[model samples]
Target: MDPHNRRRHPTTTRLPYSLGCHACRRMKVKVLYPRPHYRHSLIGSRQCDEEKPQCVRCTKGGRMCPGYRDANQVVFRSVNTEFIPEAQNSHLRKTSKSGGLLIESISSTPLLTQPTERWEAKAIGHFLYNYSLAPTKDSPGYLGFLSDLLSKEPSNRQLKSGVLAAGYASLANITGLSHLKRSAEKHYGETLQSISMALTDPAEASSDTSLTAIILLQMYEVCYLREMWQSFHNDHSQAISDITLVPQDPHDKGLVELHRLRGNSPSRTAAADGILHIIHGRLHFNSVGGLHPSRIDAELAFEGLNISSSQDELWCIMREMSESCGKIRAIMSDPRRNMPESAIIQSFDRIFAAYLHLLRWEATQSLTRSYQSYKMFSREENDTHQETFPYKYHLFKHIAHGAMWIGFWCTTIYALQTLTRTSSLLDVQLLSRGWHQWDFNKRLRDAIGEICACVPYMMGDVDQLGLPMVGKEGKAIGSFFLLRGLYVAICVEELTDLQSSYILKTLLRIAHVRGIKLALRPRSRWFAQHGIAT
Candidate 1:
């Protein structure tokens, strides 16, 4: 048996031995999509190369897309991988194996240009590792036949492209093999350690190490989010002292304009002066305070700031209220969860107001104008001309971030407002009024409506919102986010200390049973639009 036929792992594709197989040329199919020219479409196609686009199968099928089954008839085979150094050692090791970049490589040859079967094999390994829909395997088939047939000397470079492809595959939620997470993490960590050097000497990072870092980073993020939710309940007790909050730079959230109206920073004042005079032609309540009151409406950006300021103030007030009643925060009293449902709803109402203000500010800045959800990036990733929405949901981030921010922000506001007064620590306000009067959910719904109205227009649908798209879909999803905000408000505030601690776990159990979870690469971006049925 040829040692070349032995596989590190048995997959589906096999490599070539001894530079043989004349019909390997016949099997070498150049797969182009609707367009005959593959090179031209590489740069022009708005959809990602990975995304199933309008290929010949779909073009011929008419109106319907080619499903995964149709992918089989697509007819393509990647080359052998594994022994990268042997191929790179020679000029013949140039072409790539699978995926769009593989297609791309054919047009642009590598620095070395002895186009031989070795290069084809190693390139195939890189492609299968990076972009193969299935995990790379050992076979004459696309899955695993390569390691068995292709014979070459050992090369670390061969693994470079392949490892990165593996990362992309994993991140996109396709397991080349049913890899154990902990084992994958451990093995992947070695890749991370080696890749750390790449940060200092980035050029040394071939596609392999760079991709490993990205995947590792993604894993870290996923783990971190999960831990955050687990630990978020106890967050109400986690305090941010007045001294801790570094007076935030306005640009931190990319917030604009209000600092100038208030005349806080010298640099901001300078920028404001020009923007007022040149951009809006109005400069009254700012440095030059003699512009007509009638001209106040002229500066759209400033008006947005004014509204945003009010919202912030509202959030500050609500945060204080939630802190006072939160099961985690109300620990001064025993059993720790004496607050009623009404109080929680009231807190939510104010928080909802704050969220509305944030959205307005975002809209004014043109941040949330076109974005739909972070989960779904535009098909035209390179199209810089497009304007996507900035994701700032009803004044919150992940549940834990929201909790910490509210806690942190409210604590600061409380300290700032009460600097002169001292005895107000235990003071509780019993509102005779009801949550219905405020009805902040309605306000949140409207804000969502405005954001949704912009999505279709961004998606190139200029007509009003409609079903299956954004109009009805938008309302349903928008209301869903609004509901979630309310639910979090409920979760954070309506609990005993015991309840707060287990609140997340309990919700997870319920959600698990009800199947109200986002899929593998979960995101909150679509949460609002889809109402958790996402």
Candidate 2:
């Protein structure tokens, strides 16, 4: 009988030759079989293009296409891997006809031996690695409290689920991973359910974990949820209606309570303090000074924290300005109530006082003063008419300095707009001569210009500047700071139709790019009112 024609024993018969080159075969060899993408697999219809140097599949998949091996030298051999213990178990061993070992390749992609861990741990780690804003231990980022809280109460279901939701959502947003995105939505739903349960229990409702979970839910909605923008728009309209038409008491949860609930770490405490001030000053427009006992306490608090002096002064000024604005809003809301002219005059006096303080602060700041001079002297007639942001890109060496300048300009615009409205309410004879000295229109234009110039720096668009100014990792932090100032600039009645269009466009970019839904609220309203497509 011919040796070729003789039937071989079933156990000793060699498999048919693969279409793939040796390198492609070697990269994906498995005892069970090559996965579907490899050539001549029982499970797949794919076949490799046997190119001279290497197969097409390996090259296209970003795998190094090592040249084919000599068929004569082909031999079975054991290949060791640094895969995790579980992965090692998942792999199988097969004996060749020559009694040599055939080792399977676990994967074509290079991977470190990452241990199998809980999905919660992975999710939490992913979220912090990307979203943490804290540049240093001393100055905790906005999401720093999440770390502290999780460390203390690792099993808090509500907080854990919230963190998981945010982590998965952010990762999905960045990588476009459908499974992770679905996981995010699933965790978000679980978190909402957990929070609902927590709210019903009296002890859990006011817990820090619950509060932090609530904060995370807010952040998740702002960063991940697509429908949140429309929801925010609906709520914003209702909010406006409540503020302007209703006579509800100013919402104050009390500073004592906030101080009590503040986090343990300095970073957490500092973040909580800043948040307290922002909620009081911007959200409710309540007076921070009124809540505190004396000027010394506020000053001491500012000094103890990593806050900038310029911001400290500006906040002091803004607290008063916001209070004045709130009072004016309240008065305007109640046309039926007999509000005396003296009360209205008092509010105007406070506004004027804040305006003067703002001017003095600007003059005293070397950085702000130089920037102002540059913007004032650098513009050409053509540039002024073009409705573009004035001045070159100025780098902020310090976050505090950036905040200080942005806050100053924001406060200045608010003051000017307030004065314009207040002047209309007051008799012309009663208007202060000093209010007339500064051209409110020119001042607004200048302030808006300066604020616009700060956008790129704040957004980390100029990473070429070499400052760690809120890069991709700290987008939430940057967006948090940008929202209030940008909204204030956009809302100025003195803004030109051209300027309004430009600023609204900027807000739209921030909403979509930064993934901050709060931005959409103002942008949608502005665009709707202006008859522009949002």
Misplaced by over 4 Å in model 1 are 1-74, 77-176, 179-187, 198-216, 219-356, 362-534
In candidate 2, what are the lDDT values of residues 1-534, reduced to their tens digit?
999999753232223454356665765542222334644543332345566575556666677777665432333321223333334444554445586666554566444432223444666776665455553432323555567767888788988888888877766755666877788899899998997897676557656676667667756765574643344356666544432231222222333333344433455544354444433333322231111111112322333444446556666777667667656766766779877788878888877877888788767876533342223245566674553454545566534345556666766776677676667767553444655524667877877777777766666665435444443544445545666577767666567666666667767766656545456666665655454544
Residue 441, candidate 1: alpha-carbon lDDT:
32
Each prediction's Cα RMSD?
21.5, 13.9
lDDT of 1 by residue, 1-534 (tens): 789977655233233421212222234423322334555565444322223444433344354443332222222433324223344433354444554232222323243433334333333443333221211121111122223222221344323333433333333232323332333345445555655555455344423224323433432332222222232234422311211222322221111232233433334322233222222211211111001011122223333221223334433444333333232223323554564655544544443444344345445533322232323244476777734332221222122222222322222222222211211221232133233322333432333333322222222222232223334211111121222322322212212333222323323422232222221112222222233422
Per-candidate local distance difference test? 0.30, 0.58
Clashes of each: 46, 0
Query: In candidate 2, residue 423 scores what lDDT?
Result: 73
TM-score of candidate 1 versus the correct structure, residues matched by position = 0.26
The regions of model 2 sitting more than 4 angstroms off are: 1-126, 129-131, 135-141, 148-152, 170-182, 196-208, 224-310, 337-340, 365-388, 398-401, 427-432, 464-476
